[model samples]
Target: MPSSTQVQLVRRPRGWPTEEDFRTVSVELGDLAPGQVRVRNEFLSVDPYMRGRMNDGPSYAPPYALGETMTGAAVGRVEESTSDELPVGALVLHGLGWRDVTQADASAFRRVEEIPGGPSSLHLGLFGMPGLTAYAGLTAVAGLREGERVFVSGAAGAVGTAAGQIARLLGARTVIGSAGSAEKVALLTSRYGYDVALNYKEAPIREQLRAAAPEGIDVFFDNVGGDHLEAALDVLNPNGRAAVCGSISAYNDSAPKPGPDNLSRIVTRTLTLRGFLVGQHPDLADEYREAVTRWFAAGELAYDETVVDGVENAVTAFLSMLRGGNTGKMVVRV
Candidate 1:
């Protein structure tokens, strides 16, 4: 028998979640049943979407039921298995995260190619969901074209960093991004290849965006909503497109905030704003992964990760990531 240390939500968070809202529990695992596999996770992913799951409310995905182990994305190896489909020592990716070990029917896990001595955590960030989100947003949703001017809000996190670089690679004439800090602002320009990086905290995002793109933006990749969305709406050129991936700005808000003040621009300028989930766009995953692989192998793509050691620190990583403490993907090294 083996035991797995798992984090469970004891209570629904009121606004900003505290460590008290969760409890770490140790559970004994029985012998593997037929068709089952046990995985010792190498990394646990902490993402912005996890915040929405903490509350019992309507969301794209069902809310996390109280008392169950918190679930997201994790990559690891099959330590033991009864299913021939997943043999021991095989690398796998699954949704049973927040736990150092996971046991489930083999069907719940997806096989990913092994990167020898590579950080398995990359599956949770670049070349995975975050990268796919940027791809679908820019191509399928925003219809980005060559020489178009592009803007990305919250351009420091996993998806943001990917979005900025992808926009440039896709032939955008100018790539502009806004971040919450000076350091992130530097990363956007120096590493992520953004032509203009604005510190949103130092000035109004709409003012900064206007100044950066005096010619108006052709595409908007929005991760932060509220003022960021309003700012995009203010400067989007006619027939511009926006991929509304998230609204981290209002993730913890106790009440619904008002809609973007300049939403009328959508009608007046024929701008397109589409909200999407990466899971809903599997049609693009294969294409995204292929491009990422090629770009990375050719030394054309760049990424970063903020790693917090230990499974016990998963909650800390999640909270810190929500507060913009990480430059890229935030993962717990299990």
Candidate 2:
């Protein structure tokens, strides 16, 4: 038998979670049953959505139960296996969070490959769910067409970075992004090929968006909902499309903030706004992976990662991402 270190949810957090909400404890692993494999976790993901899970309420996914292991996506190495589909020493990625090791049914894990020198924490980011979310949300949901103007909020984070580059690849005539800082704005425009980038915190978002998308935006990839969504709604062209991804601006709020007063724009302009959960669109996964792989291979797309070391720092990374402290996908290396 082996023992694994795991982090369990000790309490449901009211606002932002703290270390007291979690408990790091050791668990003994019993003998693996048929179709089960033991995995030694290498890296784990700390994403904004996890915050929703920490609260005691119904969401797109189930909230984490008190006294249960805190759940998330993780990349690990198969230490032992009793299933034909999974072999010992194979690197895999799965939704196994905040633990040094895990034992899950083979079907719960997928082998992670093509990572030279083995996959780093980046696999759970750029080439994983976050990247897929951006790719699919833009093309499949937003109907991003060639020569259209695109605007993205939270444009320097994981999905935002990918969304901007993918929009460019899809022949968007102009790409604009808004981030928290001037440095991130520079990164979006200069490094990621966004035509116009604004620091939303320093200037009025509506005014900056007006300047950025002077012709009116054809597509708006929304990440921060409150004011950013309001700003985008005001500038949408007739028949414009908007993809509603994560709304981080409102994620930590204790009360609902007022949204776009101009939601009527959606009706009058015949604009479309669609919300998405990445798991709900599994039909687009293969296509997204193929397209992104080609773009990455050809140097047409790029990715960034902000990694915090160890499971103990997972909370820090999560908080940082919500505060726009990261330029791309935020990951934790265990």
RMSD to the native, candidate 2? Answer: 1.5
Please, what is the whole-model Cα lDDT of each candidate in the order they appear?
Answer: 0.92, 0.86
Best by lDDT: 1
State TM-scores per candidate.
Answer: 0.98, 0.96
Report lDDT (Cα) of residue 81, candidate 1.
96
Q: Which number leads on TM-score? A: 1
Model 1 Cα lDDT, one tens digit per residue, 14-35:
9899999999999999999899
lDDT of 2 by residue, 158-244 (tens): 889989998999999999999988789889988887999999888889988987777899999988888899999989999999999
For model 1, the superposed segments whose C-alpha errors exceed 4 Å read 116-118
Pairs of residues at least 3 apart in sequence or in different chains that clash in candidate 1: none
**Candidate 2 ranges with C-alpha deviation above 4 Å:** 116-118
